[model samples]
Target: MSGIVDLTLTYTNDVAGFSKEASKVLDVDGWNASTLTFYSHCGTHMDAPIHFNVSNQTIDEIPVSNFVGKAWVIDARHVGSKGLIKPEHIHQDIKDKFVAGDGLIFWTGWSKYVNTPKYRDELPRISEALALWCIDKKVKMIGVEPPSVADVNNLDEVTKIHQILLKGVVIIEGLTNIDALQTNCVELIALPLKIESGDGAPARVIAIEKYL
Candidate 1:
């Protein structure tokens, strides 16, 4: 109950632009291998500042250290469908000590709807106020259970939120399995592919629970 929790969603053919084909078999090619292809922003992924044209720094240009941080797992399961997470929803402890380089996560329990339309169409997202709060607090990254932090349909709303946070905060979306985390705090490790000039990329996100 107190171990690392994998927070990344496994990519599948159901997801857009994701495909896998057996390229070699043990009997045929004397080895086993598959050709995997997926979109850059597929499944669990990180957004770079260049994603919204906030900055020219690509995903690979961002230092690896920025992907790891002391993250606080906020209980966000109460967030309603198509709701906004405002400043008050944040725990006081996180707000009080949310210094730069710290990470924040929303455990919204939305991953259960993966592959369903609800997963993307009716997600709880951070409000513009909350986005500014994250900037003011100078958080290193923000992880969410939904595919995107804002409504994918609302181009203006989604763009505004992403641009605001992507100015500095690393945005990790499509997170899963935070409900299994025993501790509220964790050492978050998110590693993404070093795609040249990539605006975003899939990442292997995990949470190492802090045992007391």
Candidate 2:
């Protein structure tokens, strides 16, 4: 499928002193196994309710079915310089694609800048109106290509947006390959690690396009 897209970043260990052996092979000679550990919130991931709510559900507590579903891709690429996704900024065609319980992936074309200072420091944000719109629309979850839907430097907006959406909706961030999707609707499958009582965990996200 030439239109198929893989929207998760390829992870690697960059920290010098952060490497350790997570596993080892005794039967095989010269074999070593290690996991480059880092924060669960890093890389391509989903934000559980517990991520923002002190008393909310964690990664494992959320149902797996909630993370997998049909999704609509809203192309908000024209507002790139502003870094904000407003409700009105969403096209009517894209808006019409929304259905209750469906996943919503905002295509801002920002995932291309992952790890850059601009991506995290001055990344595009989702306005409160947009968050509320998603909630009102009964969207199952919201996914964005940037690290956070809101700018990390803007603490107030970031926290507010999180609280507004995380109350019942899952949030997925740091998605790559979004620019590769052509379908208005695709089957989105994003599964996070079952970290017991963990607020959030990295996830592997992919989209399967359907054609008539």
Instruction: Go through the candidates in order and give each one's C-alpha lDDT.
Output: 0.90, 0.80
**Model 2 stretches with alpha carbons more than 4 Å out:** 1-4, 15-30
TM-score top scorer? 1
Predicted structure 1, TM vs. truth: 0.96
TM-scores vs. true structure, each candidate: 0.96, 0.89
* Number of residue pairs clashing in candidate 1, backbone atoms closer than 3 angstroms, sequence gap of 3 or more or interchain: 0
Give a tens-digit lDDT track for model 2, residues 120-160. 77677899998998889888988988778786777788899
lDDT of 1 at 83: 88
Model 2: lDDT of residue 177: 84
